[model samples]
Target: MAPMGIRLSPLGLAVFCLLGLGVLYHLYSGFLAGRLALFVLGDQAERAGPGGPDAAPGSLPEGTVDLRELLAVSVLAAVKGGEEVKRVRESNALNEKAKGKTREGAEEKMTSGDVLSNRKMFYLLKDAFPSVQINTEEHIDAPDKEAISWDRSIPEDIKKIIQPKKVPAESVTVWIDPLDATQEYTEDLRQYVTTMVCVAVNGEPVIGVIHKPFSAYTVWAMVNGGSNVKARSSYNEKTPRIIVSRSHAGKVEQVARQTFGNKTVIIPAGGAGYKVLALLEVSDKKQEKADVYIHVTYIKKWDICAGNAVLKALGGHMTTLTGEEISYTGSDGNDGGLLASINVNHKALVDKLPDLEKASHK
Candidate 1:
């Protein structure tokens, strides 16, 4: 009974297109820069820093990894992340129902829809995707970060390293383990938070979806550009044309304005997927630079998923700060900074970009 694919109205389609190719997926699934997909799965990827599966192959003393083991670890990570957010969501709901609009808490609060969406998220991840599976251990001590799930799309070698529990994914191949920043979500913020999974066999994704267990809506897509299960988002559109971080607003806002002009509009703060999607929104205007996603910081796999799929489907591209092609099943982006270039040429950006380390850090 949940919607089965990505659906968009003419207006929604235009909004999605402006968001990013990832936001418009169904054409193809990819990871996003911030995802421009809707929300970032890497709600707290920055906290995880760069280790575990994210480690460069050669950087490891072994210079190799077992896929199964990697999957297990990632699954563990995803589960912890999920649980933490769940707790936050429920607590926020209870607190809000008591306060009833006279609340002063700045945390974005959940709506009735978020509660229902949690059920749907477990359904798709557990039942829909054919190539992915989820295993939850109640007593499992989640890491400091939280939200954990296993991924098997990686090659056998990586699987061998992780020693993951091999199981059949649902009809959809992608497994999105979304953890929208609970802090932001509970604050009743306009931007959504989520992580997504997109399965591309021979370079085509038949599956795409986003799960927002903390908001009134859970937006996702499947097959082709059908906006199934649309999540509630910013309709008020004070339209300042600015981008703020759900978790790190002050820092990201400072740097974002440095790149985008001071006059840029500010979208309500949300997760990376939301940010990526927000970046896409700017493209609707005439500034070609809106398409360009500049990474002065780091990123991760959970951060990219559905966003990546949406953009690639629409002929857009995401790269590293170095302008290297980003790999989803290959590496976690936080290790290498990310850069998204819309219709514009990013090679020029890479060529001209000053070292943030030298300039910003200075």
Candidate 2:
């Protein structure tokens, strides 16, 4: 009465177990492949959200792009550009020419170093993040082929400070000054020369890299993400050593003297990058170190964006002479003049300056 069930042979039971195992293995493999696809094609996958695959790269929801990866790529681009700058200088093949006139009617020079470095940096950045906006100093057609390969490795020091974070790709703007001190470079003042890169999100610079090719020195920072360099501990606020452009020092010198008094010690220097480095106490020469950098004339975003990011990382400020924060969104030139200070009261410094326009005319 209890024995109505038919029993399977041992061989049949073994085959049944093998078939079940095969099904499980297939499912496991499928799961892994899905994850791999997400990792490899993250940008495209994220972009293909509710808007479909044709959606703009920045149209994806905010906080979807990894900023850390962008920072690493920027550092690589800057260092590579620095290498190119050094090479052109060493070869004595600048082929320097007056590219155009600045806002103040000074002859703005462009050299082989600028063109070569711009090509090197631009291609690297564009290849890595095609969606991000890049503003370089020079305008050149994209090459038929990219010679530089992308490097994804982040610097060890940078890795220690920055954490995983994301921003909208559309909100990111990269500013590149392939050769910051071209005039200084032509004058054989290699110490002032630098290759710089900056990452500005929503018009706020969040990352900066300044590489001095001659010295093989690099300092980088991410705003609120820490920096490899430290802010200068001691500031001569009493005498307040001020750094101004050697070529365009006349107006700033007059302003510095008027604001900080005749004893303010106006140190004429070349390169916005160098002046910012001076404020950070990154120079070996004592004279290069300063309390503030003043430029009472027109300036470019590419020239100061990296330095601005670095200063912001160190709890400093760079703004217009009127104490208004400069915007890097629309135009390349900032005619409000520049007022930058590190570990010092920026507003207080701005308050001391006489009317720059009146002072300049006088």
Candidate 3:
């Protein structure tokens, strides 16, 4: 016992550290071994050709990390590299659309440089939150290109829910702007700005953001639920409010009356983004401590992705009316309809909806 006082000296400590480093190196080596093939071939290399130098046709050693996790991380990294590509496309598209909005002025278009500024806003998001990936495959592309213009002439309300993404996998989708309201931005039409971004978390938009750049705002909500429906001035339990389309004057009026009652102080504005902003402003207002906001209508994916991020950051949710999670796996990039709410728990929407459905049926 007396001899054991300092048996383990600095040499022993050094040896322990060496063993720890050795264990770490082994783990690192295993991970690298599993990913070597992926790096050379890419995610879809198996379909590239019969066999390549990098292709591994055998099993991995035991204790190796799961390939699926590696795949997810790899895909995520590649997608990030391409985010700026999306920004460039958005900039060019919006710049082209801005000319359209200018003509719509009275109406008023965003400045020629506004498109670039808007692109920067997206960059801000990427820089600020590295974890939240930007997947813009919200049906912005069209098969024939000719189909693109055709989709635009359709009713605004109708186009809002039309799916546009080419679902690449259970987790991947291609977003196409069949019609991203060029007439509004081109002609300076304030309320005409609209586009959708389909989102998927393992192929779903647990949340979405719908932006109306001309209005300089956006609408966000989770895909599986609603927000707390609180106002800026008071979190007081007042009548639920619905943010409707401003450009579609008639529909907006109808929705306002139907959802908030004839006496409801209509939160009038332009773009779906405006509607969501109104709710958020009210929620943030010191006068209120409210819990949620609600959007009751159709909106495509691109229109909601960014805003969904914001709403989610602020503790809100957006979802479909059927109590299903908002998903971007649809062939086109749109869902039939979406129901957004603030602060309201997702379960509450389910628990309370059946009774509302029954009452409506009556």
* Best of the candidates, lDDT: 2
Any residue pairs clashing in model 2, and if so which?
Answer: none
Worst 10 residues of 3 by lDDT: 144-153
lDDT of 2: 0.83
Question: Tens digits of per-residue lDDT for model 2 on 88-162?
Answer: 999999999999997668798999899999999999998878778899999867553456666556667766778
Least accurate 10 contiguous residues by lDDT in model 2: 51-60
TM-score of each: 0.44, 0.81, 0.40
> For model 3, how does the per-residue alpha-carbon lDDT over 261-330 read when each residue is reduced to its tens digit?
6764434334443344554653222121223333344455655544454455456555655566555544
Each prediction's RMSD to truth? 25.2, 6.8, 16.2
- Order the candidate numbers by TM-score, best to worst: 2, 1, 3
Q: Which number leads on TM-score?
A: 2
The runs of at least 3 residues in candidate 3 whose Cα sits more than 4 Å from the true structure, single-residue gaps closed, are 1-183, 187-199, 206-237, 247-260, 281-298, 345-362
Which RMSD does model 1 reach against the true structure? 25.2
